[model samples]
Target: MELTSGWADPEPMAEGGIAGLSPYLQDRLEREAIPKSGKDALPPEQDRLLDQLLSAAFRE
Candidate 1:
């Protein structure tokens, strides 16, 4: 007969679960997990477009 701790061992995030997801989704999840302030939260497409627009503005 043995007693057990009520709490279960925590699972590691890098080995399974999210590892099963596609790389794109994994990157999205990782980005979402970290909190960002101001403009850092913009999506990659938006950032790229914004950068292109800024460069065009400078070229004019």
Candidate 2:
């Protein structure tokens, strides 16, 4: 005869998983907006946010 391990039967798995929650917060205020003066250049607020996102994603 053969012996079996103490493991139990398998369980069912879900067909799908949950989604992330960051994209919903893509606010314009957090992005680059044209300056009131109409000058065409990168917005400071976007730069700040980019730095923050990078730091948050790649921090040790």
Candidate 3:
């Protein structure tokens, strides 16, 4: 659920936070968790609907 706000920010390591991590750990996390781009997120229609639902559910 890391894409399309399904989870936390897509590229959570953008600040190079993984640099201090072990090579193997960094490699594994990058390979498995990093999303390429927003275009790789959920399809447009579903993403829009999901956003609407989340917004309503979180209404102030």
Candidate 4:
């Protein structure tokens, strides 16, 4: 499926927010929780929610 738009904007981190964090913590956050470009797959729960939303919108 081609998703042309409607991607949600990521919330901006506060200035200097991550600077005080340890390198290990920063690396972990980037690798796990933080979103990055080119990663198109959503977690299964999110996929289910999206499917349900589309189904409901199109139901007649």
lDDT, candidates in the order shown: 0.52, 0.39, 0.51, 0.51
Q: Per-residue CA lDDT of candidate 4, range 26-56, in tens? A: 5666778763322343323556657976988
**Segments of candidate 2 deviating more than 4 angstroms:** 1-44
* Cα lDDT of model 3 by residue, 1-60, tens digit: 455644555554432234323456556666888533333334335566579769989997
Residue 34 miss distance in model 1 (angstroms) = 7.0
**Candidate 1 overall lDDT versus native:** 0.52
- Tell me the lDDT of candidate 4: 0.51
RMSD of every prediction: 11.2, 19.1, 16.3, 18.3
Can you rank all candidates by lDDT, best first? 1, 4, 3, 2
**Winner on lDDT (2 vs 3):** 3
Clash count per candidate: 0, 0, 0, 0
Model 2's alpha-carbon lDDT is 0.39
Residue 9 of candidate 3: its Cα lDDT? Answer: 59
Which pairs, if any, clash in model 2? Answer: none
TM-score for all predictions?
A: 0.26, 0.26, 0.26, 0.26
